[model samples]
Target: MIDGSPLVPHIWFNQSVHFRKGSIMVLKTLQASRVLVVAYPGAADNEAYRKVIGNLEGRTVQEETCKTATQGEVLRMREKYEHSPPDLILGIGGGQVMDSAKMLRVLLENPGKSFANILEGPLAQRSIAYVAVPTTPSTGSEANGTAVIKGSDGVKVPYVTRLMVPDVAILDPSFLSTFSSDQIFTFMGDTFGHAYETMVSKLTNPLIQSIARSIIDLLKLASAELRQTPADARGLDKLMQAGYLGGLATGSVFVGVCHALAHSLEQQKGVAHSSAVLSLTPRCLSWHAETTKDPIYSHLLSEFESIGLQSRVSPDVLAGVDLLLLARQALADPAMKTSPIRMKEQEMMGLINWILKK
Candidate 1:
């Protein structure tokens, strides 16, 4: 809607995406007698959750709260629901919560398969329906099928299955009302990174680029508006819309080096994924520009500067991390497969050095 055709919003999905201020009301209309809600720890106290849950009064609703999504948690969730799987799963939180719900839905339908099993092979088609309700306007998990869960070995493993996309996605700006100032910037950074990376991905095409550019435009408008009015409803709607479009772009193409590095940092140092992405995005953009001498990459870098996005990651926090190992992990990320440059391990190390300005 921001910059593309009217059909642009609905072209990417056969599924329903309710994008409005009070879209949470749509949750009450879903036909499910048995429901499972995988949510953030404090979601029960939130007015949105309370209203939705209250509306589903007669339905048998089970709740599980997760602060972080890990393979262990998914396994535990599977064990809890394997016997009597919910007919519908409502993922009502941020990216991690939605991802947990997606995996849970997959594992429940697949039967006896763990995250390890799915990662090793193709997943069976999703049987049960699930709806995604994202509280944070980041990761675009609500719009995409990819789920990155931390493994037992402390590396995040990405699992992709076409069937993993939610049957419905609800984007309600009211849910974003409680985010702190730090959270606002960090999450917006993630959305920007998705758009930027998609723009430069090897799998990118003209259509995907249009979606990515639209996301960037929406982010710019949202950020500028939010700067003037912290609680601006229009800004929140724009951000949520941008997030969904970014999801469409990333799901169609890929996110390359910035996300690769961010995933490694998240698994290795327990850093916030968005902070790592925010810190690495500008660096990766410049690296791509200098290494490839492409105007596209340089133009992206200029656009990043113009947007005035900033990262909150502390260089001191990364000082203790093993840069060499981090580089190796980044190169090993699935996202790297789509990077414009297929850097060797040593090259990755050099990029890491530049990223840290060391």
Candidate 2:
């Protein structure tokens, strides 16, 4: 629909915008008078949430903090909202809470459908105004079209579709001031994966390249500054923006071996999602570049070279072959089917070896 690209434009801004970057302005355009804000664990007790809620002048707000939600717990939440769902669903948290909100939204719109039925369809099932407010610099769930739920195997199975994209993303810089340096780095790697996959996607389109480039550039800038200095609001804001844009870009498109590899780690290796990306992202890029040799896979590789990737290839990268095996064992993501270039076991081993030797 958008020039043959799967991505949609998601408006964004935080403290870095000299002028209004349009996130709040877009919210005002929705013309909805009532809003129910569902927040993640620990948000309500924090003064930050209170301060933010206080600033909203006339909007009637009821704040509910979601404790760690289980599968059954989510179903109950949906049941409560079924007869009388809110006018708008505002999700405020990391992946888990955001994803739960997405499911609730879907189930509420299509009554009598089993949750399993809801999972099978593309996200465009119906129209519901959804606003996403991310408090962390990671996960990029704020703008993505997919909502991942933990499956029986404990792996995240993503619900994918065009309609799932958030109507608005509110990325207030003040929200992420509490993250440690490690969290910022892990999230930035995710932005890198988004850029890499979209650029090299078997389904790559010319239209999303500029947005892909922006993700790459933002990650590069964020990576350098965060590695050297302490994480601050400004750097955190840019990193989150980069990751947010990356998710928006790749949610329609998707990250390739890196994310698949990360998924594997998530299921089998017991790694955090952020760590999965950080540990394998660079290696995945190296392997994909060498294995696919895609002439069009341009942006991320160039950024890698610019950022001393040529000099700092690691043993884990050299071990990409092992990781790929895990990826196959761990993940069955759709992106794997459409990767611009695919990798076999031998090629993956070669990538890891190259990285380790470098």
Candidate 3:
């Protein structure tokens, strides 16, 4: 019901997003007595996360951390808390941990149903509140409702529903200070891809595009500031804001052909998600420019080049993979449907070949 009208395009936030310095104060506002905290290993040792625990000292708290966000892990977590579900599920990590938190929340609320069953059918409203505190600024999992969990077969399955959106998002930029310069770029590269795709997404309207543009601009400023002063608080704060806006925009309109191709590479070669995304995004931009013959696409590519991201993948990663099959898989993703250009199978294959070569 929030900005759900069909007449205009507006970014809808189903959660309350807080951009603040401390993470503990947000916990006081939640109406939860029992809390299950799913966090990254060693996260609870940090000051912010520790303060969160301190705030809820008298409340029941069970903390769990998993290395991978997979369906089996979620199912196991589900069984552990099935009889006594927590009133709030607090996710405290990067994308995978946050994703695990979302899946755990969903499965706990709906017992006796498989993940696939819930993904395929209508889901009931969630009773347990979900609060997300992102330890990393990359995925923007806090602002969004989609959880991409790897299945048993290793394919990343995306479960998209408004029901999965966190009830609150606590973005504390201090967590970003610990990231190395190289790590910062990797995360910012992911953010750039999100903003770039959202700007040109077929599902985008004026409102979404405006926010996307702001994200890109803020990233540019933050990148320069971080380069001059590593881990500058002001720079990281701006980056955090950009990350949140990137999530809001991409979560609304969804990513496009770049993500589609990146997903294919990740599936076939086990390339890291952000690495594949950074590697293929510029090539996707080039393809869009050539195919659409649009000046805006060309300009966007120039702006993206200014970000100075280095692709982390080696050339041999695609060695023996079938370009045609890869193209088909990339095209098959639902993300491709939101692309500005609808490429044919052959055309997509050509782009893949070009990407690997260049």
Candidate 4:
């Protein structure tokens, strides 16, 4: 059982086993016979996934493919499987797929409740087991309990519950082979943003700080390796491990301005999460550094320089956009509450303008 003032979920990492072997071991350990496999629509026919599914020889498996993790999708999934709930809900893919599975498990456990009920507070502990198999090195949804799903209004909504944490998380480097070097760099930026935000969060404690620091170091190493050899298995493995640690750290301490701004960009402009976060990271860090004398931001900047990572937001990207509205939206985000330094709407606008200018 997870113990402490704040609970941390159990995570597992292995380099030797393939996905097929890993799935079998997890299912056997949970004594699960009926499984609900949730993944991206394209993942269902992938050869790697086919091999993994084939390992469930004697068990019953039902597959669901989702394009995005939305409230409507969660409701539909719950309605489809409510009568015959699976013993295991396995999420395989990136953050969206894993988040869909997490929310699906929430609805399954609640029986007749609507997805909106989650906004009130924490739900009861779910009895259905969940296993997260992340195909991407970003998001770290496998090791985290919070799920960011698109609301009916198209805004991103985050639901948090310790009970939603996955029962198991499997990390395999083979999955990283699918991404190009640029994609890998973007994902690494997301990982670094998570660690940086959490490290500077007001809720951060010694344990969270340690995890965040270690994650930053690992990301630096992975970034360096990927710069030279993008497909290095060992480097990708380190990236995966850093992603997991970053997830766990943020799971407890949460994020601040960077995530808040990125969520707005994602919802309003349909910017990819990693790209938005990466673009805003330098400005957010600069804002924090100006407000406080914390050495962490400076240290992160130096590390970025060492790794040859760029953190400027391009002006052409935000051309013909309403900076005022986006800044207001970001200030309203719940993530803003965790920021070590708070800002008003005007300050947020100033920050947004500064980022655009960089």
Instruction: Give TM per candidate.
Output: 0.91, 0.78, 0.91, 0.90
Q: Under the 3 Å rule for N, CA and C atoms, how many clashes does model 3 have?
A: 0
Q: Give the TM-score of candidate 4.
A: 0.90
Candidate 3, residue 98: Cα displacement in angstroms equals 1.1
Compose the digit string of candidate 4's lDDT tens values, residues 1-358.
Answer: 3322332333222222223223334444446899999988888556657755876668898999988988888889898999999998989889999999988997898875676576454456657888888888878888877898888888777777666788788777667777888788778878889888888887887877888889888888888788778788778888888888877877777899889888888877888888888777877787767667788788887765555557333445565667887888889998897888778998888778777776
Q: lDDT of candidate 2 vs native?
A: 0.62
Best-performing candidate as measured by lDDT: 1
Q: What is the C-alpha lDDT of each candidate?
A: 0.81, 0.62, 0.80, 0.78
Return the number of clashes found in candidate 4. Answer: 0
Clashing pairs for predicted structure model 2, backbone only:
202-340, 317-352, 318-352, 318-353, 319-352
Can you write out model 2's per-residue Cα lDDT over 1-358, one digit (the tens) per residue? 3222344433222212211122344444444566667788778776656665664447766666665334565677777777767777878787777777766677777776655676453434455667777776666677766777765455566676545566667777566657776566656655666777776666666666777778777666766776677665456667777767776666656666667766765556456676666556665665655666754444456676664333433334323245556645533665565566556666545654554554
Candidate 3: C-alpha lDDT = 0.80
**What value does the lDDT take at residue 43 in candidate 4?**
87
What are the C-alpha RMSDs, in order, of all predicted structures?
Answer: 4.6, 5.0, 2.6, 3.6
How many backbone collisions does model 1 have? Answer: 0
Misplaced by over 4 Å in model 3 are 1-10, 45-47, 310-322
Residue 39 of model 4 has an lDDT of: 85
Predicted structure 4: lDDT: 0.78
